[model samples]
Target: MPPVSSPGLLDGTGALRTSVEERAARVRFRRAMALMVMTLLAPGSAQLVAGNRRVGLVAFCLWLGLLVTGFVALVVALVVALVHREWIFSMVSNPSLLLVLRLGLIAAAVGWAALFMDAWRIGQPLSLRLTHRRAVVGVNGFLCLSVMGTLLFGAHVVGVARDGILTMFGSDEVVGAHDGRFNVLLLGGDSGEGRWGLRPDSLTVASIDAETGRTVLIGLPRNMSSFPFRDGSPMAEEFPDGFDCDGCYLNGVSTWAQDHEELFPGSEDPGVEATIAAVEGITDLEINYWAMVNLEGFKDLVDAVGGVTLNVRQPIPVGLPHEAHFHYIDAGVRKLDGHDTLWYARAREGSDDYSRMARQKCVMNAMLQQVSPQVVVRNFEKIAQASTAMVSTNLPASELDTFMDLALKARGQKVSTLSLVPPMIQTADPDIPLVHRKVEQAIEQAEGGGTKAAGGTGRKPKATPDAVTGGSIGSLSEGYAANQAEDLGAAC
Candidate 1:
């Protein structure tokens, strides 16, 4: 045979190199398959001492299916590249599938980690069984906790398929304003009509500072009278259907038609503009959005959140003779369901809405407290279920994400609750002081704005325009009866 030429040497070496690469690939593939099989069959690091083989097998099979799919796709891509001589194209396409590939790899890693952790405990000496059992329990508990954390965090963003009252608002358009402050008008209506859809039961103005993540909820009494709907309508317009008003205050919305039968017949008409104007006047804050959740809606939210905890200083019994008799709570810490929560908030006779406000705050605080990692995880499905039906907000879907993100960050932050009752207003002029500039100033300061310092302690009072007072604070010069009249007028 002729001595090998240099060209021949190069060609032979290239073939050898290719063969080596193929063999190496085969070895790697076999090793991976073997490793997977061993993981499935062997206890590895898991405690075979307490193995539920069926569950383990199922989990393993699912994990294997994912891994196999990833590997097959990778192999197919490689084969196509080799056959078409399009290595560059294949390389480019492979990275596009990185998320799926990475996810598969991550699942594999977690499975192995779990197995190893279990194994470590299992491999311990027999003397360590008690301690090891405890450790295993802890590990399992942690796994459950991890699952729940993921669910709760995702719940706020996810909505169910059910047709929840499809209330729409403006598409979210972010106009960045420094110290972005938003005033939300919360309307609470007392609709005497039983089971008649939704109506606001407690009105609260939530002033949220986007920049500082501080919020204040200011309660407005439903019976407050002077807030004429800005549309120039009579207060009795809401009662036009000739509803019995022996004791029940006419729904605020009824005031627009002046109780004229010709205008709004057979049903109470909501005085939206007047309600808006009244809220705006009281807070001296522009109303950016409004949401109305009736008593049932309130109950639904509480129940959905798995009931809220409230510290009850006294027992509260609500509902007249015919309605569902419910107890607000007993003294001390008690968990209240949605119905009870609404009743608790509506227990004006028990504490006259002032104490009711306190209960509202208590219930809110309790709700927040119950949102543990575990609860969130277990009720992930329910949490999503409740938000869709029980709540309505002017916040568009797009804005929801940003708002949720901000809310999460501020979750653990200190929230101060205040109700402007009795001494804060006047024994006589609860309504007068409410719309008064003094009240507005106090609110603004509490919300960390205007001339008042954040949390507004010891701040010099900004002189409220006398023109706005309108002799409402019971004429500072007049004694008790005049003060009482002023108070009554203001409260009305």
Candidate 2:
């Protein structure tokens, strides 16, 4: 009161007001930063340009480092589990118990958040200053870093979510094959079985040659008919005994299995094996192995790879009924995640099952290309985990490690994907017909010199078709060339 010359000078209310404003500004800044991080991380990359790139770039690097470290830790745990043959969840379910460790991690995260908050404030001055080019650059750089960091963090989290230290396969069971060429029939079963609410949407047989590292895929259309399962009684045994065929339709196979579960429970081997036999019969290629997976598994696999990059011949649209109906796709190359991938593989719009098979082959190629040594090394745990429910492979768990090692060596190799359909081979009707002779010829070609008779001009036709379709041997090769043949020999 004695020195109350100016209330503004001596009164603590002015100071208190300033403090309150600062606190409010900080709170606002922190919220904005948090929101920005969340936005940049979720499902898209547009947030990269939200602020200055310098800060963004720094954040991106730090996030990447964290991802690498996390991946390595996960990988080591997986390796241990693989060697020991343990469950992956053994590592995933536990949160470290040490309070000090948890507290330290929280501190680190808070400190990191604080630093970003300060950077954000620095980029925005409140002096009524005009926005300058440097300010804009700073803001953009910061945003770029944030966005990239967010993406990297997201990637890491996805990886962690998909993998763990304990493996589904035990150490005593994980084995690898050397110099062994294996054929895996990949079935994308969608039948409303188990947790995944659909039947097999796509079925592909992949042949991996360990020696040359060459992979060959043969896609089977769900509608293609032939090689009925030993029952002359009628192929539609699944549906009230004659719902469809002497030679079962692709979908009928699953139905038959469901109907006959009482006869064959604890295993759907006979039905799947029958399908394998049908494809083998059609292609004239022996199936060395098989892997049965579903659409959900396929989604998880695509996601595990961090989204595969494919050169889409068309922009496949959404909301189409999941069936054999034809659909249209806009031509272009793009990266697709799980959701888009399902649509892409199932898009038979404006076309037939043949076209759908082609798209499936494209997806397979993209997967092969995207899966690298680095990717495998980083995602081995994830690969195994995601593969658990989705895959039913004949390769024994004991040999899985060997297979992985050999597969790692074969990364980036070219894969030849083919399908049986019109042009290369034709059906009695556009929808159904089984290839008996033509398929034999194609199998011979796939085996070795079988190609000479059916392929090389030097050799004559292996065996003439009983009924020639307009001077062409209604062969599987013809079917593949006509409906399939997109980017035939490009390496991923």
Candidate 3:
């Protein structure tokens, strides 16, 4: 009508309009994607730019407060670590602080997830084209899941750590170091069926320097007899002269205490108390705490740490000599599994108790040196489970941090060993005064940065023509090198 308008022209104009709409939709899609990314980087940033200023201000302020607090805390922690490291350890070891941290992490995770959802709302996804809306939904969903999943996982790990701390270290009674050292009684308890109550098959005193963390492992054979008890203790009152009776030995102290439970009135574990008394009497070193390791469960702990490496000088039998289904661990410098390692430490076939004792020391030293912090962190859950079943201790929970610090220090230093075996002192009838003297000297040497001669405290026994016996390098008569070595690593 007005100059006869062409249908082609009208169609071209409509196509141009359609193109403009498509461009707008593309812009909306990119805006939505940007909002989600902003939230990922900074939780409330999208709302501040696009919508809900009040809510955005509150969330942003809270986020900023948290960031500032975390940064300040980190700075303080670094300073404390340099100046007063124990303070940091004490804070971490506190059950109350751990619980608070667990709850705070959970709260942070929830709050952050909510902020991600809010950011998606601020992006105005509903106003975009159908394809753009779907894309925005996918991106927002991914951001929420990834961020929330990471936070939730962190919270779970913290929870596990808190539970483990509570389960393993429940004691509240704290004991101080004695004579510039902390002497801990390490008892190897055998409590399987057909065995007399929970008797200690292996006994050792870990005398650690309070400041330096230099340690001396004092091995007391389970077969030791005629040892006195701590003065004024229940066992001491019963046997004033000494624990000298028919069929009596150091390991039997626990069984004897259990038989006469009334002797230890109000005591939760009479066996441990009696054993502590015996250790104190024998070594003349005050006992700060005791840890009883379940020998059967010990294998589980070894497995948890992914086994241990050892120098097996000879074939070690897997089971009792008389057992029909027994095997031997071949001699080599090998990484052995839990089953073989347990047998390696406990085997008695063709080996005397002294040789077995030496093997145990080697195992102890290897574990101390090889099981680093990274190994513990990687296998944390498995180790926590195994430790609960394997060990029972009377050490206070508060002292855990102190010992952890000391353990780290001890790893770099050589471990000295003093065993009351063969040439040093007869197990059947030990020299109590001489035992005390040897213990004191060992501690003195450890502090003085010197170690006893390779053979041990006293005169060395005549070695047999054969050097290798059992799994150790030295014969039983001459005393295994690991049993009484200045540097346990070198001897093993």
Which candidate number maximizes lDDT? 3
Candidate 2, 1-492: lDDT as tens digits: 455434324364345233554565565554444544543352111124455456556666665676689799889877876754223433332233223334544544443554444444443545312334345345545765665465455445444433331233322333233225566677776635463312356777665665545555666667655433333222324333222456656655656665565655455355665565555545555665566676756778777777877665434665455745434334456777776777777754444565566666667666766788578657655665666655655654434444554454445554554555555444323322334444433333444544534332122222343412211122333333322332333411
* 1-492 per-residue lDDT for model 3 (tens digits): 346444334453354234566777888888888888877787777788997777778878888898999999999999988977778778877888888888888887888788888878777878998888888888888888888888887778777777777877878999998878899999898858755236888999999998979999999999899999999999999999898999999989998998899999999889889999998999999999888888888888899999999988888888866778688888889898788888999998888888899899999999999999899889887887788777788887799889988887899999988898876788888999988878877777777744564433533333444687776767755677877766788878
Across 1-492, the per-residue lDDT of candidate 1 in tens digits comes to: 655644223454455334554565555444333333344455241332344466456666665675688699788877875654234333332322333444544554466556544443333333333544455445544543454344443432332311232333332544342337666666654434553223345667665677555555555655444333322333325433222344333233335333343643443333444455555544456677666555555676677667876655556676764666633356556777878777766665533444455455545545554566466657655665565545555654435434443444345554443344433443223444344555455445545465743323222112243311221111222211111111111121
lDDT of 2 at 311: 60
TM-score of each: 0.50, 0.51, 0.88
Error of 1 at 406 (Å): 3.3
Q: Please give the CA lDDT of all the candidate structures.
A: 0.47, 0.51, 0.84
Candidate 3: stretches off by over 4 Å: 1-18, 125-134, 191-197, 319-327, 449-466
Task: TM-score for candidate 3, please give it.
Answer: 0.88
Error of 1 at 23 (Å): 31
TM-score of 1: 0.50
